[model samples]
Target: MADTPQANPQTARVLSVSELNRMARDILERNFPLFWVSGEISNMTRAASGHWYFSLKDSGAQVRCVMFRGRNSYLDWVPKEGDKVEARATVTLYEARGDFQLTIEFLQRAGLGALFEAFEKLKQKLQAEGLFDETRKRAIPAFPKQIGIVTSADAAALHDVLTTLRRRMPGIPVVIYPTPVQGKGAANLIANAIETASRRAECDVLIVCRGGGSIEDLWQFNEEIVARAIVNCSMPVISGVGHETDFTIADFAADRRAPTPTAAAEMASPNREALLNTLLQQQQSLQRSMSYKLNRYMQQLDFLARRLLSPAQQLTHKQESLAQLGTRLQNSMLQLLGRQQEKLLRLSLNLQHLNPNAVLNRGYALVQTRDGAIVRASSQIAAGDPVNLRFAEGSAEADIRSTAKPD
Candidate 1:
């Protein structure tokens, strides 16, 4: 108000402070590129629009900050007031307010151990969430017919595993899933292979392994993506990353952790020699059990045989009775024959007494009258008769004239 701006209208029209600031903003924004900056956050405010406003300051200097939802949401962590933070920002000016500010695309706590601390915090959180539970651990099959190995094809660990498995058990077949075991995309490749192997369901168990290396070289296993993949796998996973001392997040998340790749193979199969020994022991035990059972049966049979009666003794008792029967049979036959002989003698005597031929032998001659007459009582005499006489041996013939009856 003190200055006479009307006296020089051209100068008045030349530039206002706000106009100059706006022009400067356009120029600076057009020319400058995005860069990283470090400072502690102050006066931090989050808008309902999902935008963040804050002041970034160091010991003496300070800058304004704005993180839109698009960029801020990608961050896994957020910064609070009094928290030292790093920002990827572009130097730009707000034309309306004529104030310079930083548009932050990303943010991280500023410290050397920030990443490690974040990792630990996440690990503890996931562990508490039961993601790293022992109950979820699966027992490896004792004798897998087919085994899937997820490792680099050219890795020495693969050879070591194969050699060990061959030595311990030569019968099992191995399916190899060639994947990067250490590198930028190693974790993703491993996870994809594991998923594929599970979907195939061809192998009973999977071995996700690699050769030993430094922690940084084996960082792929440390990644959370790999750990989650291991946890989500349906098949039991044996993590054999690095040496015994080297552990990664994958190791904790896996169903089992092997001390070495060779150990992983050993766990996948059973030792043939041990199996043979067990079978032989079982056979021996069966033989012993059978022998004892057979001996018991034989002893029972012997005891029963001793209690049995012999056929020879029963037959001897019957034989004595048979002798008495034979004597009875012979005596009955003799009595029958004697009775028959007596009847025959009686019949002969009766025949002799009544026989006419026998009477002839007794001197009683019989005569025939053929006109031979046996003179008994009939007509003992005839007045004029011719008679004939007959003896036992001879006869004489005669003529008969007449016969008369005597009164």
Candidate 2:
């Protein structure tokens, strides 16, 4: 296992090729614990049996690594040629070929680990302060009247954002708050630009953005000051600082996060064609509402017209009612007079029937005694000697000597 040179046969014990290989493997495995190796990938090969074979090398040295299906199947990502990566592996020599190699259990791309660590730390810190909370984030304007851009003037991201805005909505104005997006002191400049944009309040929304780059190139956006500036911006801020796969603290702190500068422009600007269509729809809706209100008013007018009356017609109706009442009163008076006349005539006939002249006409007579006494009895006539008699029409005087008795 030590790869010692062959000793003289006079006193040395010999080892077979297989024995040598086996001992070497045991010694290598025992000498090295699991360790990380960083290098670029080269000559990568995948066998039909799902085993990966590759060499990790820098300018000075190289080592072969084997990642079998069992371990690799759990990996979310795979390495490609020329990609810088770190492998966690144990050093071993293959027993069959006596080749020294590494048995890799895990692999990760290089450079990202440090950046990712910083990203997560800032992200969590800002999140705990409610910077990334949905409730605290501002809404992206559906249609920005004016757009403010905070990025380096020479950056391709500015061009991308400008081009996208022009394409989507040409008439919308854009204000650029230029700042350095890389190198020393760039983060402070970016933060100052964001604060300036917020203070100016010239645009409806703000886009803090830059072109894609390596982590170091985009490091300005990950700074705490830049993140705080984004959080403190008066208008909604859209972050488009890197490629889609790249993320930064500003992205988390922004009101809205866009994957790229062009995307940020698209997010902040409304499409003119789409706006035209929407305006058409709203116009049609307004017309419909006006039409409905007009129809309702027209119906009310018709109802009022039906209820309305001309003065002549109103007067005619009232006069006709009055004439009907007058006719009824005249008929009532005539009936009352006729009934009274009939009653009077009937009373007059009864009075005539009870008249004394009428009773005399029926041959009734009256008699009186002389000296103003009537003599109807024989005893009274003998004493009186004289009597007066009256017929129905005249009066007469008579004397009675005897009375006559009649049954």
Q: lDDT scores for all predictions?
A: 0.83, 0.88
| Clash number for each model | 3, 4
Query: TM-score for every candidate vs. truth?
Result: 0.49, 0.61
Model 2's lDDT to the true fold? 0.88
Worst 10-residue lDDT window for candidate 2 reads 375-384
Predicted candidate 2, C-alpha RMSD: 12.7
Which residue segments of model 2 deviate by more than 4 Å?
1-80, 86-108, 128-145, 154-156, 163-171, 183-185, 199-201, 213-217, 243-245, 266-283, 353-360, 365-407
Off by over 4 Å in 1: 1-119, 317-407
Q: Write the per-residue lDDT of candidate 1 for residues 261-358, one digit (tens) a residue.
A: 98888888899899999999999999999999999999999999888658896688689789889999999999999999999999999998887677
Candidate 2 residues 1-407, lDDT tens each? Answer: 68878778878877899999998899889989999889999999999999999999999999888999998876646778999997889999988887899999988778767877888888888889898899998888887889999998999999999998888899999999999999999999999999999999999999999988767788888899999998889999999988887688899899999988999999999988888998999999999999999999999999999898899989998899999999999999999999999999999899889876677678876566656664456556564467776777887776665666665
